[model samples]
Target: MNIPKQRIKISLAMVMPALVSLSILMTMSIMFYIQYKNEKRSLYNNTMSLNLSSAQKMAVTIEALFSGMRQSLRASANNPAIEASAASDQKELQVIFDLMLQSSPYFNSVFWADQAGTIRVVSPVGNNLNQDRLKTEGTTEALQERKSYISAPYRTPAGRWIVLASEPIFDSSGKYHGMIGGTIYLEENNILHRIFGSGAGNGKESYSYIVDSGGRLLYHLDKSRVGENVSSNVVVKRLMGGESGMQRVMNTHGDDYLAGYASVTMNGWGIVMQTSVSSILADVDRNLEEQLRSMLFPIVLMLVIAAYTAARIAAPFTRLYKLTKSVAAGQTVSSEEFRPHWNREADQLNHIMRAAAESLAKQTLSLQQEAVTDPLTGLSNRRELERCLDSWEALRDPYAVLMLDIDHFKSVNDTYGHQTGDQVLKLVAAVMSDDVPKGAVCSRFGGEEFVILLRKHSMDEAYRLAERIRNAILISKTPYLLPLTVSIGVSLYPEHGRSREDVFQAADMALYRAKNEGRNRTIAGVKSA
Candidate 1:
């Protein structure tokens, strides 16, 4: 049983609006996806920038604290009473330590170590002085240097993680007498707390910390992780190398974060601040979701309008389709002089059908011309040349094909503007097009290059044609201020080879030879015959 063609046409018309709407929706979705990706990238960059700024600020603050502590120690070192008492009675040295500790909130405790590396005095009169409690290696090294030393964060014998700040004391003879030092427990310090507190206030779901020269956590908002060694972390190693930058990392808690680090002014310490990736993209996610919802509303509205317009347009086509179907079914249905609906699209479609039937032959000819012409140069394109070559090969015509290339074309494009480069190409194309013989065909192959096919031409004739084109291009003044030259290579067909591929390959080889022999010259390929 054959279904009526009219019904098929009507069914197609009904579905056309749906297809159009789907295509539009897909296009919009792709565009929206690209926009969302760009927005997410921008957000990630912003998060990195913010983290860097915060890290720098925190580093400055910590450096200032260290500076203040150094200044205080230097002032205490110059006092004759403290220096003299440090070498004598241990109780008198303890009195000096107490004074220094009370003067600064930054110091947890102050102690005096003699030249023998013995902790003679400790401030605040705490536990009994244990000689083993002092780090002999660091104390002896600091006293030997006879200058202030800021030791990297370490675990004290008392089990407290602290940084040691020590300044050497000299006797009246300028001899190294002993060392006075203070302990700064990073855990009790407010630097990490302050940085993380501000970030939290800004609704950032992340934390900040300070790491020592060895990549050991000095101060961290996560108390449990303070003193944890992070030297093996790749990002920490990068930080130790004085590279302050941003990275995405998963912390011990298994949460992904966009972390940024900056080195402190002190030699080997740095601050790292991080924020969660999700928090950074939260705004973009919300905006995209809202945009998707809004896009759906417009798409639905357009689809409804398209459906109504399709129904109105299809009503007249429905009748016309029936008449055409009757004619096709071997029933001589008279051409109905039925008038279409008053809608403009319906009337225009009816006119289109009539025009299409009458102008089919002319349309085909126009399409053929369009296929042959190069849209940019208004010359024959490669497709047209290939078709001509096929026909010429079939006839076994003896001819020559030449390929030409502009020397230093990239230099021209870079030195001059692209507009000037385009003008140069067009000028070359026009010169070559006009210089070739009447029966020969010339085309712009692609950027700064052109090809020519010469009919019934010998190798000498082809070389002469190539030389004329090259000399014409060189002598001709282009719209660009710079002069131009071309390299041309010619190969004769039937003499070179019977096949099109062989002829083109020979021409390409000749072109290479021309380029190697210095540009602005023509080279012809040797023929077998």
Candidate 2:
């Protein structure tokens, strides 16, 4: 019986190009790494500068808005028809209130309240807290002080949070009768949107928010947080102190951000704009990618030239060595091949070629290893994951995609510091490696996220595996006595999705769903029988 020999061969020329390429690659990577880091630092500085400018722009816009609001309130207050008409004269006041609403579309409501804080006529009705004294922040001051005032954020009896801009109503004789108040509803009427709706940040991850002097959020891109206190926020704290500038801060939710803040002059309210640090670094990665693409032609050209030149130089020697020689990844050329052949020039050439071949072979393996493995986690990297997925897809093999994220992992970093956070990541990686069977590809899928591709797994099997990992992590001890939990999303191949992108996306959506559904459990995506 005849057995077929392996077709692929590793030769002297084949090894030389990789050797040259590896050396060049090392030099370029180091230089590029330095440049990459510098670029990141530069990007951060630029983002902060832009954020500060955006915050200032929004603050100035709001100030101008208040100036206009004040003018409208003053005009309404001093108007003969409205000012002289008794607060009890609802018919006369209604005409003027309707006119004020048209001119000040930015205001949510308009009202006439007498000196006793009893609201008389309210425009945009249903907001009638008429029977009660004016308890909202700024209205009472304007009535008692007999001066124009802008209130801090306060909740209306209608349960709406707003800023009340009010002017005292006094006749030409300077006798105070009542106050005119215009309401800027925090969440509705698009007033905040009209001022900050264009948004200060570049993308969805970036947003602008407003906080009162007391730290209550008057406006935020997330309406749910509008009334929540953000005084503990670094940017908000600075804004409260009348300090305006840009800085890198970690928010209350343990996310790092580049933020800029300014206090609105009218009421000492702080306006802040912020973007995520990770988002800015993504830009840096794109720059690096562009840089790599530009370098690609030169790299390929060098490899081609090196391979041709090395082959041309070794032509005669190759004829002699071709039949008897081959070098596998870990195997080396016998030292006997390096012994003196007794012809000085021929001996030296042969010796050097053999040694060079061995060196390059080792280097080729080293570069391949480094390319596919994650340095920190020692697991397969993203490139490897993609490569394996492609191979499996081509073969029409079954697999399960599990995306796992460490819950509140940011808090681990914030509380114990980044070094400790790194330790937690490693430990989690270790747990994943130990729990998941061998040959399953587990990767640190950026930040606190991990991805596992389980070969030949059904949807149920994949979910069970995810639960095992989650339970192990929850019960596992941390480097600093911190308890950790994981959210896992499982999706199966061919059933959930036939393509790589589709499958990963299914798993990712499930992963986020698990997180959204309050974490520490597995959610199966795209279920199939």
Candidate 3:
């Protein structure tokens, strides 16, 4: 099998350009990929740092609220009214608790417990009483320690989970008399709602909650998590031991979350704030997607431009190749040949193409001129006269038509030979051509006949130009060595006829009148009635 040499040669020539373009394109793509990866990594790190800072801020807010509550309760416990009420009538104690509750939204309930483990509860309501119930064992032990204590969360008889704040009361003798305590229903208070409600996640996906030393959820924004055990999580276990910790974990519900925990000072409870990873990193994800699109946009645009450049650079060569192939295949090549290639070599090729086209056009025009001219008079043939008249009439301007005949032209052609007749016609054409205005067009209508189109000129101007040509002709001596004169007939536009045929008839009638009235004279046609 013989392989084609032309195919091999073309393939080799194209290889270098393609390889250079491909190498540059691949390098750019790799660089862009690396840049995109680095951008995504940086965004991820920034998102993580921002989420951590937000969690820390929430922790600080919760700590501040709890600290304020502790201080307020401590102040209330030291009040003389509160101290006296705890020792005397329970009704008076209820009044003091009611007053404290009214003073702040933070207080849930206040109660007094005596050293005998008997408890009198002043519910959140001002007059509610549940007297002499069993004192919470945790509260009893906590008061015996002779210092203020915040007990772990526990469920009350009403099935509500609450946190207990207890402070031991002492007399002037320095003896512990009993304890003054406040019960806070953490879920009912607004602290959790404020923190978690304003937190950065969709409703079901994020939460803030308080946990006890037992790793049980004491209060959550969702309310349903109260008393739920969370000790299984490693972060929860560390937090339960009163150490602050943070980690990413899957909760019992199988949702990924970023959990931040911090223990309350001198209180056995910890606050754990959890935010879903999806919520915390949502902005980063959206930004990454936009960045990726931005990066890809340039790549796509570059590829399009490269493709266009390649196509543009190759188009001229492709056309040249096709033309060469046509010649090689023995196709007929005319004088009007295919256009030359447009490239670095275009200047030389364009000069050659222009010269060839001009030479061919001159040859074609000479042949056409010979066919349209009368040999005897060197004037337009009858066919060319009609074509010129038709073209002039189609124009949208007012003009005059004239017809001239040599007086005794046939007699001169008969006696002095056709050579003198030709001379007379040439002399007439010269006189008419020279005397016409700059923009007027004169054409040989036929042998012994001519037409003039004066653009935008008045009928008077046209007649004046015609009279000048007639006078010039009347005084002229032809090179034929014989004196000659022409009879002229003139007709004005619209006054003679609205159409070219009518104008021609009017001019002819004036010419007939000149011949009838006598020879060697000019005559103007009267307007048609």
Candidate 4:
């Protein structure tokens, strides 16, 4: 080996071409393999995106269909004639239910049940009237949950598969009073058939179906399989357990499938769209083969160019490594700095990094906003209020705190339900926010309680502002309910206390006084400066 040194020293020009040529060929092969992988990855991502979108659309349609049935029952349950549960109004209730059934072709039957679980009044005057439904899980669950419900699909004695949507009725005092519900016959319902059928088009290989949270088949193209138990199927098990995503799993017949599934919002039912694995991969394989052929000539040319300029190649690579390091270290890099003349891969990577940075920035901003904002009322949450208060206190700025609450808010929730109660809060928050000065802040402190800060306002000005807010609430009319009223308590900064806690306590005491004094009025804290 030591004696070979003199022989290995060939002319520099002759050895350089051969050494560079081999190096160029290896580099070109590695780069081509990377591009090949990226193409395949892109194809997979696009296919999965299409599948997920289709699954979401099917899930939304199914959810809306069931929601319509439940909403109809809920609306009818609120009717005074049906709520009375009186024998005298039985004829009127029957007529109302009959009208409901006539309005919606999706419902096979509509009925009202008594507290004893006996179907007292039914539309179309069917033989199922006067039947006891307490033994059934659907009716019993409705009574127990005291809310709206959708049952798993079941086959009736009449050989019809139906899902029940029920709303629990409550008396004036918020006591449970039977339920109002309707039967959604899946066997012949055009709506369900359209939903499952439309997702697949006219394709025989791809299909869509639905199953409940209990893994019971609610809908299927195979008519004989409706109401069958699918709990043993791995995909059904994941869906019933509330997992929503795409998967490649073996079907019952030992065949692989690419399946995308989502949970229906109303009933926790799973909607699945399935296609054969072979069909999905067929196009991908063909496209990949074509890509390899098209890339053959380009790769060969790149190798020649690399052999001629091998000495300069390391410079561009070093520059690219530095650019990538800057990005990884969270520094912004411009795309124009890296021209494709030097390296096309560098240009592509620059664009990708720029897009990623921009997306991350947007997501960070959105998360920050969500953190400080109340979801329901669109006002500052308690955390935001605390932070703003601390900032003001640190600056020693003068401000007024107005503590406000909706009168009889619990009664509203018990009567009209929680959804309406949320609406009431939003209305109050909106009114206060609009009427307040530009620098002022309105926040939801907690349930049924709101706080307002009026900066640079004197005690009398603060009291006047509180009075205006109270008057606005008194005149505000809810869409479905009577006018709402609010009581307010005003506390002045530095006059009541130098700290946030003291001012809050003073405002709380004053709010209690306002509540005691015939309600719907504003009371100011005692001046203590």
Best by lDDT: 2
Query: Which RMSD values do the candidates have, in order?
Result: 10.3, 17.2, 35.0, 16.9
The digit string of per-residue lDDT tens for model 4 on 464-507 reads: 88888888887888845598989899998888986778888889
User: Considering TM-score, which of the candidate structures 2 and 3 is the better prediction for this target?
Assistant: 2
> How well does candidate 1 match the true structure in TM-score terms?
0.58
Query: Model 2, 227-246: lDDT tens per residue?
Result: 89978988888888988999
Ranking of predictions according to lDDT? 2, 4, 1, 3
Enumerate residue pairs that collide in model 2.
Answer: none
Model 2 per-residue lDDT at 100: 77
In candidate 2, stretches whose alpha carbon ends up further than 4 angstroms from where it belongs are: 1-16, 87-89, 200-204, 314-529
- lDDT of every predicted structure (CA atoms): 0.75, 0.80, 0.66, 0.75
lDDT of 1 by residue, 1-529 (tens): 9986764343746764654465466557767888999998888888878888888787788788788878888777777887677557767777777887887666777777777677777785763436554554455567777788988776656666767788887877888767788776666654346434555323337667778888999877666677899877766787788778888887665677888888886757888888888786787889998988887888888778767867756555666555444533544433233355587765654454344333443555678888987766777888988988988888888889999999888888898878878878788888888888797888767777788999899888888888988989999997766678889889988888878888888888889999999888898887756
Query: Which residue pairs clash in candidate 3?
Result: none
**Model 1 clashes, total count:** 0
Off by over 4 Å in 4: 1-44, 83-86, 89-92, 127-134, 157-159, 173-175, 201-203, 281-529
TM-score of each model, paired residue for residue: 0.58, 0.56, 0.49, 0.44
Candidate 2's C-alpha lDDT? 0.80
